[model samples]
Structure formats: structure tokens, C-alpha cells
Target: MYWRTREELSLENRLRRSYYELLRDELDQFIMAHALKESYENFKNNNVAYPFVERKELKPRARIPKDEFSLHNSFLVIFVEDTIPQAYKKYIRFFDVNKTTKTNLLRSKTLSLGPDFDRSQKFLDSVHFYHFLKELLPVDYALLIQRDTSHAKTKHRYYLSHFHVRIDWPISEAAEDLARYLRYISKDVYEKGEKYAEDVQKKFFEYHALPDMIGGRRTAASVAAQYLRRLPFISTVYVSSSESRSLYRYCEQGVSRMVLMRLTTGEMEQVADRNNMPVRELKRFYMLDQNGRGGIFLFRVTYGHTAPAMPPEDGKLREIKPELFWITVKYQHLLPLPGIWEHPPLRVNLIYT
Candidate 1:
């Protein structure tokens, strides 16, 4: 995720991408909607519904909507509950004046008025608001509005840019080819029912965008993509949840975290169906071991391919297969990425279909 300004590539109009950030915010919502729909019978009006912000002016107003309309914008939520509940109490202070001194040590404070005060000028009601939003975002627009991450960027206008990725030495075709083949084999190991399937759907089904392609700036999807920029640029194929926890523990032992990345969002949206006090904001970060230079740097090179890679001898290998790259790191490599294989999605041509 940490890169010099020049290393980043332009995916579309403005956003650059890394492999980890597979799903965009809108697509995340769409995927959540579809995922929840499968088990809608168990959901309740309160369990899934929440207030959503529609406008930002004086005392912003929010519209409460159904469960589907309230899904959080997170591409990755399986390992952890992407949504967090936070409470904030707002108060207006009133100072009491003393009769003699005209000053007071005590003050009275009261909670402010509840949200649901005003409506967006664009919509008549919550139903109308969501209907308008749903219609405004066509399925095709949501899917094709931008592109997904890819190693080859020039050919695919929508593919995420990746020149920032660094490797210590020259890469070979055999290594790349073997990686693809192994990734194919590993599919059976990862196909662990619902969780794996959902991740696959998001990895392949959802669309990705360069920050600029959407708003000339980085969005949640574009930022989430940075997680791939960590020491291990390779896919998390070999590392299970427990393995990753171990890596974190190791990183914590005396490895002074130098904030290599920081993400900030100006907007906040209500996160729950209850009082609309605690809202969600999009933020991401990358903490590098500033201490790594003195200890040692381990270049964890693994043959990683998410999709099958064709042989370079094949005419369309480059077109259909993913390219190989290195993910050098600051400390001893964690989670053995078997030298056998690991990678990212194919170019847009085969990916979307």
C-alpha cells in the first residue's frame, strides 16, 4: 500500500489498484444485497435496516430504509464483521450565572434533536429515495462503470494499474506458468463452501475502479485494494486466518510500525437501525516495520496464481494468464507461500464473462 507517488499507475481516469482490493463500494452493497436476499427470511426490519444519509447541509438529515438498502460498503467482510457499532452522544451546554458573581461553575447539557429532520431535495420519501438510487445505478453501470485489477493495464482501460509493484530480480516464464497451474490445483483446497464461494463471487463478479474513474479521487474500493501492497504482494492463498494472526504477532514484537499509509473520508453514514448517532466512515492504513532495515529483509517469493495461467508458448497466454511479481518485505517472511504457486484475475475480456 505504501508507494512513492510516481510508482502508482492510473487504472482509469484516476484510481490505481492492487490485487487485494477486489470489490468496489457499490458492488460491495450489491453483493451484500444478493447475499442477504438468500437468507432474507431470517432477517427482520430492525436487524437489517438503518438510516442512510442523503444530503449534507445544515443539520444533515437521514432516511431509514429496508435491510437491503442498509448493507455496509465492504468488499471483504467474511473474516470479520465489517460493520462496527459505535455510540456518540452530542450535547448542548448551558452555563448557569451566579446571582452575585455573574459566573457559574456548574453547567447543564442536553442531547441534541434526533436525526430525520429534513429530506433530500431530490426525493419525496425513503421509498422514493432508494427507488431513485437503484434506478440511477443500472446493473451494467455498477458492473462496468470501472474496471478490475490486472497486471496488464494499457490494453484494458478499466483494469487497475500496477507498475508500483516491485520485485528484487528478473522473473521467468516457467515460474509464472507453474504458479498458474498450482493456483488451479489449490482451488479445491480453498473451496470451503459458503465463505469461499462468496469471496470468489466478489473477486470475479464485482467491478473495480481507479479512484479517478469514479470521482477523480480514491474511493473505499480503491483504498481497500492497498491491503495487497503489504510485504506480501502475493495472494493470501497459503496463509489461513491463524497464520495471518501469527504474522501480526511477529510484526508486533519490537517491530516499530511506521505508518506507511493513511486513508481518510470526509463523509459519514449512519450504521445502525437504532438512534442514528454512530455512523461509519471509510478509512484504511498500512503500517510498515520501520525497524526492518536494521534486522533484515526477507523477500518471500512464491508461485501464486488465483486463476490458471497459460504457457507463454500459447498465443494468448499473456491475454488470459496473470503476470508474476515479487512482494519483498522488511522482516522474516510469515505464512509459507509454497514456492509452488499463487495470483490475480485475468484481463477484463475473460473476467467479466
Candidate 2:
């Protein structure tokens, strides 16, 4: 559905979320079955089965594996508007190159500044953005669209295009929360379930380092977290690590041995499976396995919450955790927050920048 109103957008979001959740459940089942089969095979071949063995690297870069792995590192979040800034003109090139030229340039297999958009102002539209993104990402990347055309304030409505782009495989392999932003710019694209624009090529470029290359020197997630923390609309933020910190620590006994087998042969026999982890304590295991070690979850303040000014009468309500002060105080906003708040996770990187 083409969402023209906030209510329509919210409804569509809910429906889309339901659809994606069904798909996620199916994918989870498939993964479980496949993992079980793989485990049984491993037990037959090597006399041991890993509880949650993933044969494939979740985010493989050039088909290599290492102790430390980074996921969501290749993603870039951008807010694109109809107009480009004067300073940003140098970074953008107009659509002058032919189809063959674009193909050849991408096939060069080297990083590029990508199409400069200085002259693209006149002809630029949704199609241009699609093509720009096509050339900007790899074949495996997932393009998530969130069209921000509606706002209570008229000036805020720039028909801005906010994209959460990942240069990785399907969205299913990524965090489930990201699926909420999956939207189509046009109804035709939505109905067709496919967008054709001569298929853009993949080449790592400078755009991915956005906010950082512009002297922000912070990741997209970091920038977003910083901005959202101050807003009265936001109640809390949950940040998790994305990359695997220690291979041995996160890996199952069988997987650890398997990792050892791939890396070295001598210690395979010596490695033993970790004691059976309880269901309640599998949070870290699940986090590492799902490649969701690092993720930012934002909880917004609802109407039910007390107004920003009115702190609850209870002293506990007035008291803010010292942990949360790092996030609130860092912005130099000394105003005591309302009672409605969730204590920040102790392990999270409070100062993301």
C-alpha cells in the first residue's frame, strides 16, 4: 500500500512487520533443521556434534574466516533529500556516464568516489536514487527503504529518503529489527517485488564512511544513537556488540574444535565442548550466533509516559542511574529526566563515538 498518512504508514509498518515475522519463523525453522543435520553428520564423521554449528561464515569477506569477525560494519545509513548541500556537491557526480561505462568502472574492482552528483540536480529523482544505490552496493546487499515524507511540521517534510543499506546477503541473515524499515518508494516496485535498473555493480567506496569522512569521525550507528538519546521522544537505547570478541569463548565445544580444525590440526582432540548452557543464559551465545552482537535498539517515549517536565514524586523516580548519566550528561543537557526510563545496559559502549 502507498502510505499517504501517518496512520496508513503505521498500519503498513505493522502489517509488514507481521509478514516479516512469519518469514523469520520459517527461516529459523529451516536453519534449525539444517544445523541439526550438520551436527549429526559431524558426529558421525568426527564423533561429536556442536549444539549450534554454523558451517558458513555469517558475514564472509572474500571467503576468509578469523577469530574476530565484524557484522554490520559494511552498512551505511543515509538521509537523502531532494536538494544537495553546497559542500556535498563535490562528492556527488551527475548521471553522464553510459551504461557500459558504469559497468566497466565497477568491474575495475577498485574503490571509487562513485558517480559525482553535481550535475544530477535537475534530473534526480527516485530512479536516480535507486541507480545510485544499485552502483553503490554489492550483489548481496539488502536495500531497506524508509520514505519520510510526512511530519507534523510542514518544513520537516522534505520528502527525504532515509536508507539503511547493508553490503551483505539477505535481510533474514541480518538483525530482524531492520526489517521494520523495509518499504518501497513506489507502488509499482512494491507490487513487482523487483526493481530493474541495468543491475548496478558492487564496489567499496567512500560513501560508506559517511559522517566519518565528513569529519564526524563516528559510525552511522554512533551518530544515530547520539542524536536519538537527547530527544524527549526517546525513552531508552539498548546497544549490543556486533562482532565476535573471542572465537573460543563464543563458539560451542564442537564449533571450537571445528574452528581449530580449520585453523590448525594439532589441538582438535584437546578441545572439548563447553558444559551445556542453560536456556536463560544463552543470550550471549544467541547474540554471537545471530551476528547481532552489536545492535542499537531504541525505545521511544509513548503518550502513557509522564511528561518530560514532571518527575515522579518518589525519590527513586527522580534518581537517575549513574550509568545512564554518561549518555544524558554527555550531550550537556543538565535537565533531570522524567521518571520513566530504563537503565542502560552495563556492558554497552555508552560513548559510541
Best by lDDT: 2
TM-score of 1: 0.18
Least well predicted 10-residue stretch by lDDT in candidate 1: 237-246
Question: Where does model 1 exceed 4 Å of error?
Answer: 1-23, 26-34, 37-143, 147-180, 183-353
lDDT of 1 by residue, 1-353 (tens): 12323244455422333322332323333332332222232233347532212111001011112222323221111111111111200110111121111111011111112244222311212233333233322211111122222235432223111111111111122222222433422333233444433332222211121101121111222222222223221211110011011011111011110001111121112111122333221111111112222210111211121223222343232222212211112231211111212221111110111
Model 1: how far residue 44 lies from native, Å: 4.4
Model 2 residue 319 CA deviation (Å) reads: 4.4
Which candidate wins on TM-score?
A: 2
Report residue 319 deviation for candidate 1 (angstroms). 25
lDDT of 2 by residue, 1-353 (tens): 11122244456445544443343333223222222223334444664432222223211111222222222122222222122332432222212231123343456442243566332211223345434543433322122222233354332222213222222222221111111112211222123223221000010001111111121112223333222222222111111111211111000000110111121112111211132434323223221122222211111111111122123344232221212211011110011112212322122111121
Error of 1 at 330 (Å): 21
